[model samples]
Target: MHTRYGSINREMLIKRSPGWRWIDWEELSHYRDLLYFLTIRGIRARYAQSVMGVSWAIIQPLATTLIFTVVFGNFAKLSSDGAPYLLFSFLAILPWTYFSSTITDASVSLVQNSLLITKVYFPRMFIPLASALGKWLDFSIGLLVLVVLLFYFKAAPGWELIFLPILLIILFIVSVALGLLFSAMSVQYRDVKHAMPFIIQLLMYLAPVVYSTHTIPLAWQKWYVLNPMVGVVEGFRAIFLHHPMPWNWITTGCGVSIVLFILSAAYFRRMERGFADMA
Candidate 1:
């Protein structure tokens, strides 16, 4: 009886020792319910006290697209790769908004939840994961608006429509990758919070959100696709406008996202060892 009791005690100790793992799938699954509630709470809390509520999601991209249409499309007379300038900018804005919002919220998630982080033993990664996942609601609302614009323009997608899912997956990977890295750094150094906005603003221009990638000179085109969102935005336009797929850009984005995800996950896990102490 004592031997059996000792064996049970050992198993309990082993189960409880969830050390800093890079990506512990089993441990995350064990706490899946926590992740679910955290994601739901983030979604509700996001719009609960807002004046416009969920409409803010649609308004942001729509407003930005209108400004770009006026300035870049009309004034500058930029190329839209043959698609309507309004539709072109809106397509890029959808993913850019989602990517920006996710990382922005996630960058402060750890600090915001310091109380819980210090007191809880669950996976710390869940905090940022919840932030990243919550933005899907906003993305879906924007996607609905995109559908309406597609009809208004009478555009039709072809077999290339199948590539959309892959592009979306890469977009998600890029967002979460940066989200994890920024959140981890934000915990130890508050400067990440202040610098994040400028970083995001810089990235927006870098990724061709306000202009067409075609406008990028042939000399710079190879280096330009290094920004993962280049592929994502151009892929969206290709699908909606029935243009040929930008295979090189898309593949480069996939490779870059994978590398970033691996590095960010490792860095996040390493940094999390001191999170409770830092919090």
Candidate 2:
């Protein structure tokens, strides 16, 4: 009886230990090659049979920026902090596009990879991570357009450009956090994927993508930065347009993004165990 029990325990241990752990850095490291493979797969899958292919990246944001310039910049006469309306709108749209795509892709990653989730035993976060990374590749491609727009408008890059990476890291953290949270919930509810586009649209307006937050009444602006993207967009413009960088807004954005990221990641890890069953 003792020998039999020992064999069973060893089998259980082997089966369980090889599976994902809660925030296991070492295990994730072991599977880094899989992450690379999935990320490249995601990029290829995005443009697989499309004729336009990766050019779609620049076209989407460029088209939206042009529409915003005509509608918001021309018709509504929205302020762009004295910058050229087209360049102003494009800068905001750039980051917003990156953030929106990251969340959208990452949120649906697990459900979309249902077969892999059930058949494989790896850190499922890789699904979202790879999705986010693939989208990051798109964002990098899109930046070439932004550079062209900057030269077209004669907008000089500012010293604050150095801080752009830090800001992007914060935004990326929030994207992954929300992605993981929703991806996990989506496995169970199915409604999350349905609602995500609408939710992201609402968030885009709340952000300063189309118009400057300065257009808001002074009293309300303080409450507005609570949205996080308020600071993010402002910071981006400050870099590209060489506008003023308010320490207060940047600090608030960094802090809020960090806190939300941590809480969302914890929630995701808690919900992750059920993903295989529901997915």
Estimated TM-score for each candidate: 0.93, 0.91
Residue 98, candidate 1: alpha-carbon lDDT = 91
Cα deviation of 70, candidate 1, in Å:
0.8
Tens-digit lDDT track of model 2 for 1-279? 244233555443443332333576766787899999999999999999999999999999999999999999999999888999999988888888888998888888888899998898888889988887888877888789988877887777988888899778867877777777777778888898899999999999888999898888999888888877778888888889888886688788888888887777677777777777788
Query: Residue pairs in steric clash, candidate 1?
Result: none
Counting clashing residue pairs in each candidate, in order, gives 0, 0
Candidate 1 lDDT? 0.91
Residue 174 in candidate 1, Cα distance off native in Å:
0.7
The parts of candidate 2 lying over 4 Å away from their true place are 1-22
lDDT of every predicted structure (CA atoms):
0.91, 0.83
Q: Which stretches of candidate 1 lie over 4 Å from their true place?
A: 1-21
Error of 2 at 63 (Å): 0.3
Estimate the Cα RMSD of every predicted model relative to the unseen true structure: 3.5, 4.8
